[model samples]
Each structure stands twice: as structure tokens, then as C-alpha cells.
Target: MKPFLSIITATFNNEKTLEETINSILNQKYTDFEYIIVDGKSTDNTTAIIKKYEPIFKQKNISFKWISEIDTGIYNAWNKGLKIATGNWISFLGSDDVYLDNALDKYVKKIIEEKNADFVYSKVKLINNNKEVIYIVSDTWKWNQFKRYMKIAHVGAFHNRKYFDTYGIFDESYKISGDYELLLRAKSCLKTTFINEFTAEMKDGGVSNKNVFKAFKEVKKAKINTAGISTIVAFFDFYFSLFKYYLSTFVKKLIK
Candidate 1:
């Protein structure tokens, strides 16, 4: 039997992009999935938008849930969604992001064919606010290679629910970089599969990029706090990541 995927999306006052995100999931060619949306009590029309799509979700017989209550943060909302998810696999889709055409179909088929895989991931194309292509971050890491570089895009990865049981949910202590820490822990335990295909399109102006310096500092602090690495070692890693970020941005400009 094919596995059921629970795609969780968390939103807060995302009226500008909520409908498009919902449409992306609703139009998926793959059928064996549940769509869960956890909203942080948006004071905007986000709830209204979700309600409007309720009939479409029912028509498709898609298991759907939407909660609009105040929460701690994005990761907390994610935890709530995960608790209620009944799918064999789970993937988080940001409210400002969308899957590529037939992304679900391809992912589901790949995982079913490769039954030994514990998690699957693919490339991602970043798009600016104008809908222009920014750059494509390809899947370049296998299991061992992953430790050296953080190549897994959270939005592009589908993980088995069992992995969560073994490892754990996103670390709530981190306001940022919790996803990175979770992946590091998950990869340390599970057997991952890379699809070598573009699974999703991410919108520009993500929180990480919006406040690059602050995000970088938080990530470094989170890594040290969670991983318990030596302060000097963490400093090196922090500077190294900063250097790599600059180099990557330069390379991106050169390619453009």
C-alpha cells in the first residue's frame, strides 16, 4: 500500500499568499495525502481564505484541519499540526511556498519504489516577489556528504513519521535554526534518499534572508546551545558559514 503524506502548513497573517499556497496543495496530482493548516490566530483574512477552500478539500476527500489560535511560534504551530497528522510521512510547506507541478506524485512514487528510504528530498527553485527565478539550489548531498554541508531544504524534504518518533520534533527552543538542528539529528539516525528533482519553489524574503545578520547570529547561538559544541569550534563554524554565504551570493550574481 502507498503511504499517506501529511503536508503541514503554518501561517499567520499571510492573506497576500494564503490562497495560492492552498491551491498548490489542492491541485496536487497525488491523492494519498492529508493537508493540515495551523494558523496563529491571524487578525487578517487568513481564516476566511481557509474556510473558502473547505469545500474543495471535502470534494477531494482530503483529510484537512485548520486551527486559528495563538501559539508560541512557527515551530509550536508545527508541533500542533504534527500531533494530529495521521500520515505515514510528513512534510512542511511554508505559507509563501508552493510545490512544483506533480511534486507530490513524484515524491510519493519515489518513496514507494524505494521502500528502504527513511526520508526523501529534492532541489528547490527560489523565486522573488515579482515571481522571477532567483536561483536553483540543487540536491548535492548523500547521507555522508550531508554532515559537511547543510544541503537539505526543509521545504523540499519529506520524512517518514517514524523518524520523528525515533528522533523528535523541531526544537522549540530555537526561534531560528531549529529546522537545521532537527535535520542534523534526523540525518544522524535515518537513511535518506535524494530525488535529484526540483520538489518545490520557495518565495524570496524568507525570515532568514529578511534579517540575514540577526538570523545568522541566532543560528550560530542555537547550534552551540543545542549541539553543545566548544565555543571556539562554534565560532569557526559561524565565521565559515558567513564566508560561504558571501561566496554563494557572489556566485549567484555571477551566474545571473
Candidate 2:
């Protein structure tokens, strides 16, 4: 029998934080899940950290599998994991992120309660380099909010296996907004539930946060291709988002 959940991490050169990511999984109160690490053939000590934890996972009777290879992008690595995930639900985490000890346990309970939900997403804490939470992401799921932007937290969000069978895997073409693109494929019909709890701590300086303009560009493309938005409308939204981003950055600098 397969596990109830499959957690995947696509990592590259994360030697400094991969061990903490692994340890977070090891410390999870909920144990009946599989953990997969898809490495982009890191030149650092990431593989050594993975190897060190392999025996511990096996000893604990958890199905832990990993692969180190050259992938085009994060979505490609995630697609590789999706192909072999033997679970009813799947989630992705970054190598620099970590789960709260009760995270999996909370999700399992929510899944049991919401049998009709295809996607379940919870709030995530955004931590600075010093590990202090700056803010929390993801509000309650609203169709209007989703239509405008990616309002749900992608990290640690649970996607039912059947959703993949119906809508297909993450679009490998997307470098940044692949998670949003996948959900946009479902359009307005995606059944979702929001859990009002912080499930994980995501480092503030991820690729998307660092490259705001590029990420917004991909999001606009995703809206046009998958969400049935007109190119003009998408571009307008993109520019508006860009304005907001710059305004916020300016305000932050002034406050500092």
C-alpha cells in the first residue's frame, strides 16, 4: 500500500540548508509519508547530507527516495518526482524551507475532513535571513482573488493525486510560476480548501522574491495561456503588479 502523502524537494547547491530540510521531515509527528529529493546535481555537499539521512529514513520505515541529475528547471525536477509519487496527495518544498513539527499531521487531518477538496493550501511564514518571520502569505481561497493573482501559498500546498491525472503535471516550460500555471489549468473549477495555519517557514529570498519582474512576467503568461485571460488584460495586470512591487520596495527602504 502506498503512503497518504508524497513530499518532494527540488534542490540545487543547497548544502548549507539541505540538512535542516531533511531534519524537519525526520522530526515530523506524522510519519506515514514518502520524501523525495530531486537534486540538480549540486557541486556542493548536498548529496552527502542526503546520504547521511537515507539510513535514518529507512530505519524509521519511511519511504525516502532521491535522484541527482541535470534538470532544465525546478518544474522538470518536480515532474520527475510526480511520475514516481505513489501517494494520494503530493506537495513540494524548497531546500531552504522547513515544516513545522505538526505540519503533516494537520494536513492529514484536513484531508480526512475535506473529502471533496482537490487542493488544500495553508498559510506560510516568510522568514528573513536571520530566521525572523516578516510576514505570512495566502488568504482564504476566493475565485476573484485567484483570478487576479496567485493568492494561495504554493509551498507545502497539498495537491490531490487525481488532480494530476485530470489536469496533468507541472508545466516544464515555466521557470518560476509553474505552480500557479498548473492550478490555472483547472481554471474556475478547481475545488480548494484553505487551512488557516502556518505550515512552513519559507526563506524570504527565493527565486521569485529575488526576481520579481521575471516572476510576474511568467505569471502573466500563465494567465494568458491557461486562465483564459486576454493578452491585453494580462499585460495590464502585470504592469499593475510591477508598480505595486516597486512601490512596496520604495516604502520599505524609506522605513529602513
Candidate 3:
């Protein structure tokens, strides 16, 4: 029987957290799923770790395929994974992140019950290197509300394969915020179901987090191209985003 979900993990020299990320998926209560890992020619022990778990994956009947090569960037790796995925629904799991236990089980159940939703989203927990959960991102919003804030993290989103057939894959042009652009496009064409549960635990210090200015520039461009919001609205949104970023930074310092 074909699996209902395809989870793609993109990585490059992520040996430190790769095993934990892989184990999270392998240990899922939901058994029927496909896992694909796209590695960007890492000069690390990531490949060895992946190989070490080959027998375990085989025992579980989990379909696993990994490609190690130099890719253009993260978006390109994600696009590669999407093309090879063979499940009814698709979701991306960064190599440094981990899905909550039984996350896929809950997602599949919701899909069966809803029957008409094309995209599904949920909350997420942010965790640091020590595996200490720092904060929970619990905001859920429809397309209109999403315009105001990007509350849907990529790790917490799952979409039907049909969505890719209609709208196409992630734009490779965006280095830091391609997922954001993809979500906006998906929202414009499909009705999304927001599940009130934590789907995945996201690792801190991702590319977007590390390169703040570049991410901001890409996000602004994405808002202009993917989002149909007017230029004036986009400008205001950009200004508001800058304000929010600074405010959050200040709050974090205060808490520290």
C-alpha cells in the first residue's frame, strides 16, 4: 500500500542533529510514509549516520532514498525531493528539526475527517541545541489573516500532491524564504485546514535566522511577487515586519 504522506528532509553538514531528526520520523506512530533526504555534499559524518540506520528503516518497511550532490541551494534540494516523493501529501522536515510523536497520525486522521482540505497547517515548538523547548508558536490563520503575519511555519504544514500539480514547486530563486513564497501561492489557490496541535519541533539557528538581512530582502521580494497584495500594502507589511523583528529582539534581550 502506498503511504499517505511524504516527508522530505534537506541537509548539508548537519551531523550533530541529523540522527535525532531522522529518529523522530522513524519512530512516528504513523507507519505509512515515505522519507527522502537530500544532502548537499557534506564533508561531515552525516552520510555515515544515515547509513547506520539503513537496517532499521528496512525493518520498518520505510521507503528511504538519499542523494548527496552539490545543489544550487536549499530550495533546489527541496524541489528535488518533491519531484521524487510518491505519497499523497507532501511536507518538508529540515534535517535539524523533529516532528512531534504521532504527528503524522493526527494529520492523516484530520485529512480523512475533513475530506476537502487541500492544505493543512499546525502549531510548532521552537527548541535550542540542548533540546530545551524555548517557545511554542501557536498562531493559526486563514489566508486573510496570514497576510498580516506568517504564523505557519514550513515544518507544521502539509499539502496534497495535487497542490504541486497545479501551482508548481518551490521557487529556486529564493534562498532564504522560498518556503514563504510557496505557502503564499498555496494559500491563494487552496483552502487550508489549521489543526490546533503542535506538529513539529523546529531547531533554532536556521539559514533564515542566521542571515537576517538577506532573508528580509527575499521575503520582501516574495511578498511582491507571490502575494497579490498591492505595492502599498506590501510596503506597509515590510515596515511592520521590520518593526516586529526589532521588537522581538528587544523582548528576547529583556527576558535574558
lDDT of 1 by residue, 1-256 (tens): 8888999999999999988888888888887899999999999999999999999999999988888899898889999999999998899999999988899988988888877766788888899998899778776556454544456677847888877887789878766566766766754555777777887999986545556665566666755665555678767776787888879878978999
Model 3 C-alpha RMSD to native: 2.1
Across residues 1-256, which tens digit of lDDT does each residue of candidate 2 receive?
3238999999999999888888988999888999999999999998998999999999999999999999999999999999888989999999999998899988888898887788998999999899888988968777777877987788888999999999999888888888988988778799998888888989987444557888999999988888888899899999999999889888988999
How well does candidate 3 score on lDDT at residue 86? 92
Candidate 1 TM-score, C-alpha based: 0.88
For model 1 the local lDDT of residue 190 reads: 55
Could you tell me every candidate's TM-score relative to the true structure? 0.88, 0.95, 0.92
Model 3 steric clash pairs: none
Local accuracy by lDDT, each model: 0.81, 0.89, 0.82
Question: Per-residue lDDT tens digits of candidate 3, residues 29-74?
Answer: 8878888999999999998988888888889998888889999999
RMSD of 1: 2.9
Q: Is candidate 1 or candidate 3 better by TM-score?
A: 3
